[model samples]
Target: MAITKDTFKHVDYLWDDEKAKALGDDQVALLLYRSNILGADLRITNYGGGNTSCKTIEKDPLTKEDTEIMWIKGSGGDIGTLKRSGLAGLYMDKLLALKNVYRGLEFEDEMVALFNHCIYDLDSKAPSIDTPLHAVLPFKHIDHLHPDAAIAIAAAKDGEKITNELFEGQIAWVPWQRPGFDLALQLDKALKANPGIRGIMLGGHGLFTWGDTAYECYINSLEVIDKASQYLEDNYGKDRPVFGGQKVASLPEDERREQASIIAPHLRGLASSYNRMVGHFSDDERVLEFINSNDLEKLAPLGTSCPDHFLRTKIRPLVLEIAPDTDLSDMTEVKAYLEKEFEDYRQYYTKYYEDHKRDNSPGIRDSNPVVILWPGVGMFSYAKNKQTARVASEFYTNAINVMKGAEAVSSYVSLPLQEAFDIEYWLLEEAKLQRMPKEQPLSRKVAFVTGGAGGIGKAIADKLAQEGACVFITDINKDNLDTALATYGKDTGSGALMDVTKMEDIEKALKAACLKFGGVDIIVNCAGLAISKPIAQTTEKDWDILQSVLVKGQFAVSKVAVAILRAQDKGGDIVNIASKNALVSGPNNVGYGTAKAAQVHMSRLLAAELGPDKIRVNVVNPDAVIEGSKIWEGEWAKGRAKAYGITVEELPAFYAKRTIMNEIISVDDIANGVFAFVGGHLSKSTGNILNVDGGVAAAFVR
Candidate 1:
């Protein structure tokens, strides 16, 4: 707690006075400190939902005299990640001046554009729409949070009465009003009526709290939220029914996950009809209680209460209806049923849009539901990418908490449909949507790279990730796998130990990749070794090893990838890394060349076999990639150098000189070749070989 705490059953007191003292005189810094502490707890606020601000005295640049300025959280940023740069600073005089021109409620949106004129710091981040809430308040420090506990009280049928009795009129209640100038004016009027209230519950919305000092504001926010949480928990005792009691028992934990994975890709395909999307699955305990509850049919259709959650998750979730404990053993039937539900959802959304479209409303967006509820499994959230999908899931979780709290205390309520439609299609919200950067080519795609520890594999993984694909890299080298994962980033990729030749290892790695990201859209088989020896010198073991690692390894990885792709019903890409030797023959390279040839044919065979299923297989032939190559680790480089009558140091030059273009091949060249096949350029051209040899005439397809 920043100031006071007797005890809080639902939240912890984390404020350190010593830390606040060290931040001396920097009111904005104190504001950030307050924002971060509240944001750290999901119970207090949702991601990117709440806003905070402080009005502080600072020397004005032009006047060279003490002047008041307001520092508040900017548009489209999370308070937890707030920084000095993220806070939009405006002159208090200019901002207060805005009240003079304030028109009635119908013109509230026009006031938002005027905020730019009030800004004193041109380089500061743009102010959020909620700026009016913080600016119009009388207190020096203010917080506008979407705490589930407070929203529970805000959303209950008897919210206003409950607010009066719960806090002795210390916390007031303002009925639901869309956030803008009008809401700010309403709050200001409410404060004037009740001179000493600490906070107010924004009906069907969230909580607002303020204090004279930064520390007091932070403490006040926690005390109000914690007290409300404690009240809800005390009234909603253990024996009380949650979500009108469970409708059906949960499936076993392992079974739930297994079913979720098997069903995710189909759901992804449906969601991606208008724009591609990555998915996130959550089986959190609380989510289960609600999804498996009897009241879901009655409550789910009412939709989420918070505006933030509604914007991302849509007006309501799409429910996959089936009798309780319906058999999902056959995914084909489940997928068909889901398809029917999806169509009905789209039709309903279109009707809602038609019912509310104004003359200036932006065109209808994708009709797909962002959130889906499956009774026996869990929740599935979809977005343009993984982090967004995960965040959408989290916001829905907050909505769940609010619903549960409200149901326990009073009848849970949702915002009226007209109010929600206005917020969702507001011209301001549409403008913000237009400002988002264009999606990358591989925005919602995922890649699986085998032997990612090697130079070529790592280069390919990096390229895909740069093009905006999430990668899952696996290698037999544990240390190298860890290093590769570090570079790929936590959001971009995951790592695992895998030997392609081992069936069990391949299965484990595939499962791990599916668990990290939903599934793979592209597969890169780059794992191998080169064993160059004359027929007389090559032993049976040498030949066996080469074939086992190169030919059989690629086959095994492809087998699992095809299964996943089929389950998704989404066509995929398989790129096999072969070599120029596969086309051009050479002496003392029998074993290595034979394996490469098989790898080449394997690509073509699979391409032909999987073409009907929309899976494309292609090959990239690289010649003499020595630097950072796992195949050239020990004797392979020396043997090639010896055969060419050059030192190992000169092998690169020798190989380069042999090419028609006299250029050397690098891992990046091979990576570009792989990109060429799968990076949407030649997406239609498969069962083909891309030679990255700087022009090897002998290896010409003709």
Candidate 2:
């Protein structure tokens, strides 16, 4: 495979002179472009799995002298979307000096002190662990990535041989070494021995390439990777062994998603610690193809293709065998199986840690499995937050690709379990963990908000997410749901189109919430309907619509949610968004008032019934919350304003003056009342009513 201009044509270099100049600094601009290009391809770098650096000369403001500085990717930032702040500036001389004086210091202590003391900019974040490797390299631009094509070769039994054959002495090969001072020194030695080497392959780790310019470094990486890809294609692209014996043929899409929904909550519960776990299910062609393969049990448990993945996905994924005809409704059996599986996993992990952990290494990570492989369905990745779960999902997806590719050409292999353990408990990773914020009040709680696409429901969902609860929202309007998800962010909240009156819709939404997040810890029934009419003028259709949603809808959602909570053997919360009209009926508001009154009473009855299970039921009766309220907009607001002898624009002021506090209620005020109950602040107070009506004397509840 000769290197040509079109050899790496698949990559987009994004080379516009005007656009590049606008980025302020030419080197910074080129580095950003190169990082994005490399990260754009998942085969190159998955999520935050790679780093890049550039060495440049800058004049120090204080010293009034030219200084050589190294700009490397900082911790906790994704390479695909890296910006100026994502790269930390370090004085190159100070970074390289640590190698001589730090011979006896612990790796963690030396690295931390070096990073803290050596600075080109005091405000910039700490540089990546690979900064030293970059510092010692003799190139101006450097890129280190775990591309799948290259990893296929590096993780093979004859990886060094294959690398030599492909690169023909153009690149040096370094055997697997836990990345730190030692690995940096080893790489420096390799480069020094082979002065003409353009790149280096770290067996079972990744690939590194360098050049005097960003384009040269990036293209060299691509060319080297292309060679490896070509080698696999020529050797194994044809007559590959097809792993047979799939337990069951793929199910219909709806059934697959339903199965995913049913199993998600159980997995989440198993994965949760202090923070409830969120799950991301993927049945992408690659994932499904891998899961459905006959060699799944053989390949998945072998280990992750790269050591970096051990941090996100442990060495092995938990594989659960679910028959095609298994009953998902009977969670009793499923729950039992998961609990036993988790116990066994815990014992195994403890023993594994005991066997491999170094004296000063951090304690074993949470024993819960991050990746779960379900036969006949797909895979589920669990983490405390959605972003981490999504990243794990991507890692598994890439792992499948790399492993399959490796097996196609030769046998697939990974680093030894000891090596994986070393990386998993590395002090560099521990430092990153220390920087995360403390868990929030509702960190482990999951909340479902009905009518969450609009004013009050959206507000409640957003607030719950802000407090660290993984929120699942439902609304009848698909457009509104999409818009709300777009605004609130898909990671914080997921939207489901649901008509609460329909039993199937209600069940499906609940299942989705369970699957996406774990079982619900909090339920806020914000879905409601209003019709103002005298008792005689209230048509059956009008009355039933309000009754079905405001009364029946709350009952249906709560029934399913409570069952999930009970199954988890955890106490839960249920807050109904009732109305002040439930206490003080306005003129010609018979239907709305009657239904809301029934809802309030029903909540009290549920409280009494569920109290033994530690499920608290309460009502927040908010009146005249017109601002940003879909319920109070348009015809409803106009009619209510007319009832008050005022125009629509004056309705809020009119209601405000009517209340003792002269304050118009807002959606956030109503949300706060709901949180007060669901957040366990009102733990002992159930079957109670909280008012956000600004002291409506007639509607006051003692």
Candidate 3:
């Protein structure tokens, strides 16, 4: 058939024949190539939502005879990220024979265990529940994708009629059936009856297509999805604005961000009550359009039609009621209203569990909703970590597209409540949950580290990241900051430039951190400056710069960061990196020592004032961290060496000799002090000081 530029309106054509030919004749290699490209585009399929497979001829080890083997995506991985090890391989002859042992629909689940007997590769990953769907199909190459446009057509009230009319008999429609052996048998039957059809829409589920070659299968999948998307795009907004026109105006961008900073933490706390959850925020134009739409209240609670979205976003999102341009300036008022809604959502979810639960059903999972929507602010998705939370938000965006398409041509329809309940409490899903590893101590926590590219700060960031905290780092040096971020890796939240003494810079950085990972739970004030000069030699400029960076910087960071912590209502940590000189009386250290002293007292004061809020404040004093410290890179080191009556190179040993233990202190040692204060080890200890100066007797607090 003829193709035009407009043919792929919602999705893109990514296949390259040269690249495919470069892959040689390896069928599995070709399948992986196709799966990765298809999964790479959200318009084509959501993460981990679909499966692909190909039946290949391989020699059986037992009989040394050519046998058919099917390779499909494993039980738990995104196709975009799939590797060779992520595919499950089974002997096609054995898989097809399982039909003989299957009793009926009542015993479909038992058939899953029998799949192990069909394994062609001993090291292959556990097969997906959808394995049967691919195994039973007769096509050499098959694609089962959860595309928003196709699912939109499948979820309309008269989806079957629409399918017959839109595709003109090229694509067939099948009634919704749960994914398992029974669905496999039904799909086989449907394909048998309509041998001429190129694809089938599983009502309210997804789309399926096939071809003899991998390239043909890929093209067919794209053409079918693109066609459905084009039809929906043409129909949508033609009659009226999508979602029945916007009922509420979106808040200005600045106001929307401020509102997210104020409200995300409370919602995060609610999501974490069952288990601490990391958060992700989205204000994409589409997300805002849907959240502010007149039909938001009507459509959000109907739940998603696709199973992937239902699982990721929960059965229904917790939608808040707020009139357009609501006054959200007062956090106290917003908190009161939010608490009421949060509790109500929990009660409603628990009631849903009690309403539909069977005797053998797993006890209700976290009652808190995974996806929460506020009219003007946008969407907040909370999950085990940043990646999961981000994917959850993306899945909801896909659902929004599906809803728009369905509502455009016909009324949008969701699955029966019973079907949603069954999927939610599925034993197979619980088994997958059981297989996950235990979470780290700080798995769901987020840390904002100031001066994070320097010695103490970088060490602390690395340590926190190792413990599974998503850390957002800030450094004034662009080169250092970029290098630090590269070293930290992507799983660690992210970073931005900030000069802590500048309010605008601090506000911008804090806002970025909040938007990046919802909000901050740990604050590390590690930015510092040193001006070690005798009273006669010290200049006013030296004192001012030292105080501005060391004392005022910490204060400004706390003033902004504390607001985020208190808003989250989750107890937090604030570790002030001071120095041994804070408590010790030393010559040539007037300016630096005074700033350190102020930082120490400021932390104690904050600890006292914030105790009621459960925000712990503490201090870590490290002396002679000369190896990697930026402070030792300039005049300060020379100034200290002169006062100690030693060469610059001997200053390290001099400081070690001054300590009781006579040992050098390192950056990692200071990092340990910060961790001890915040790692739940000193849960009740606050307003205290830990000295990492090899037992500095003079620095010990009275």
Candidate 4:
């Protein structure tokens, strides 16, 4: 079921004959297109280190006529896991047109020309290096691979002989050839020699097979690999491979832990000093075992699974084999080891350059090992990207497996030191370092808060402004504008008297803020009014005013904020204050509840629509806080007591006792919640409603 080498070969051989039988035909073409060759190839090879293609007739979107095209894997993608953009389409006629103009041009340029044809003719998709091979293939489906078995046998000293023994009369074999036109040409010659061969194996490289259908091609590739893997497994799997020359005893956990704790501080210091925050490590048994082993020196080098990955994880890991009590935290110990490793690398580079000519511009890297496998400690994977982090892990994992096995046969030998250096410092590799992302608490920031005059909105404004943000505050009362300016503005904060009801006023204020602050990064609409008239006595006018401010105001502010935030090209955050009444309707507060409910729903809708621009919108529903507002003192507090048939003095205690914690929600607590929504830590959350209410709302108030 799961694809492997055995299944690949079976499919490859069957599809080869099947394709030969079908030949060039319209009906067979449909069958070839139906199989999941891409999925099969990924399973059989090192994570899409293969390529699969079909010569198909695709109708032009505008012209509506069939045009012959060769669909090949795009550059920078593994065929083992093909994504939508992984495959690029090239006009067959244009690619074939280049075959005549070939007069030994630069391989990269020739590739560019072919790729350019795809870009110019079709939206400029970067064609794979194997595009020429696919273009030349006469079959409907062609697959290319670097099966582990084939490559292991090929990279061995006597690859040619071993390959002959493995295939016998069934497959064609080619000598070691570089992967571009040269390999394609060599493959052409070998295919011609066998004529009736089922598949072709490129020595020291990989395997390639083709068939009429995608399934046949995938199966053939699988079967061939299956046979090779069985042969290797039989020969090698009898016992675990051992390292030769020296064997050291592993350290126990007590010693490793002591060393780890001592070493952890230094590592933490190194990361912190370098401004890299090292995440906490959760120890696992296997990780502990690997760290305390003695074969660490043999583990670093056997790492390059593919060519490009070599740059991400280098050719080896750093081996630290020492006694359990070794004090790694001591600067003398760390520095001496670091220097010795550096010196060894320098010597290796000198030797490597003697054999291969390489330029100095991208010269030698500082050559700091990204992964270090401590003999008594587990390995560490380091990289700027999470993808590279996994790449480092995989590289080290495979290297350890191969070297551990090789130790039995002989000491593990990695790629020559200079060879690894040359690749690491190569121009292509150096290019990856350009244009690194910036480090900022809030990069290209902006914020918008309604009811900016008081309470949670002001706290949010202060928090955001502290972390390098420009804030825009709006309130219906013009009198509060000057005070907010004095408080939040403090030279950076700007206030406006824009009622959230009037879209025009909201737009005018937001436009001015964008012009003044450059753009908006976050929006916290904390402005809301609470009137506690019983439902039977609540008037439509009162309901309308509350809804206009709570519901329509949120919609208006967010709609305009979204436009400014999107144009700013920096992501935005919108936080709205809905009362806990929105969730649990209270008696005599029908108007307030309905308006707040609308505010909550609109926040969710805006969050979804604005997600494309990376704008986040969330609602915070807080319980009654009697610190600052007249609403808290005059109506809300008194009304709740009347409803409960208690004195106003007893209302706070009544609500506090209703919660499991018997704790009351404070204005400061609500302010802190709003502050978090507007700042650095809660950046990823959107459409999340947080309840800052005590037990009366069961912690579901927000």
Q: Write the per-residue lDDT of candidate 2 for residues 308-426, one digit (tens) a residue.
A: 68678888888887674578878888888988887787787788899999988987778878898887787899887777888898998878767866776667888788878877887
Tell me each candidate's TM-score. Answer: 0.94, 0.94, 0.95, 0.53
Q: What is the lDDT of residue 573 in candidate 2?
A: 91
Best of the two (1, 3) by TM-score: 3
Best-to-worst ranking by TM-score: 3, 1, 2, 4
- Model 1 has a clash total of 0
Enumerate residue pairs that collide in model 2. Answer: 276-444
lDDT of 3 by residue, 1-702 (tens): 655444576677777778999999999999999999999898988999899999899999989999999999989878888888999999998999998899997786788788889999888999989998999888899999999999998999989999989899888888998889988988989888888899989999999999998988988999899888889988979988899998888888888877776667777876777887888988889999899999998999899989898898888998877653566567677678878888899999999999999787898999888898888778999998998999899999999999999999998999998888888898888888999888877888999999999988999998988888999999999999998999865557599999988988998898888777878889999988788888888899988989999999999999998987877778899999999999998999999999999999999999999999999999999999998889899988998888887889998898889889999888899888888887877889899999999998888797
Scanning candidate 2 in windows of ten residues, the lowest lDDT window is 7-16
Q: Please, what are the lDDT tens digits per residue for candidate 1 over residues 365-413?
A: 9999999988878898988888888889998888888889998888899
Return the top candidate by lDDT.
3
Kindly report which residue stretches of model 3 are placed more than 4 angstroms away from their true locations once superposed: 1-7, 488-491, 649-664, 694-697, 700-702
lDDT of 4: 0.60
Which has the greatest TM-score? 3
The lDDT per prediction is 0.87, 0.82, 0.88, 0.60
Q: 69 in model 4: Cα distance from truth in Å? A: 1.4
Off by over 4 Å in 2: 1-18, 104-109, 236-248, 273-275, 683-685
What lDDT score is found at residue 330 in candidate 3? 72
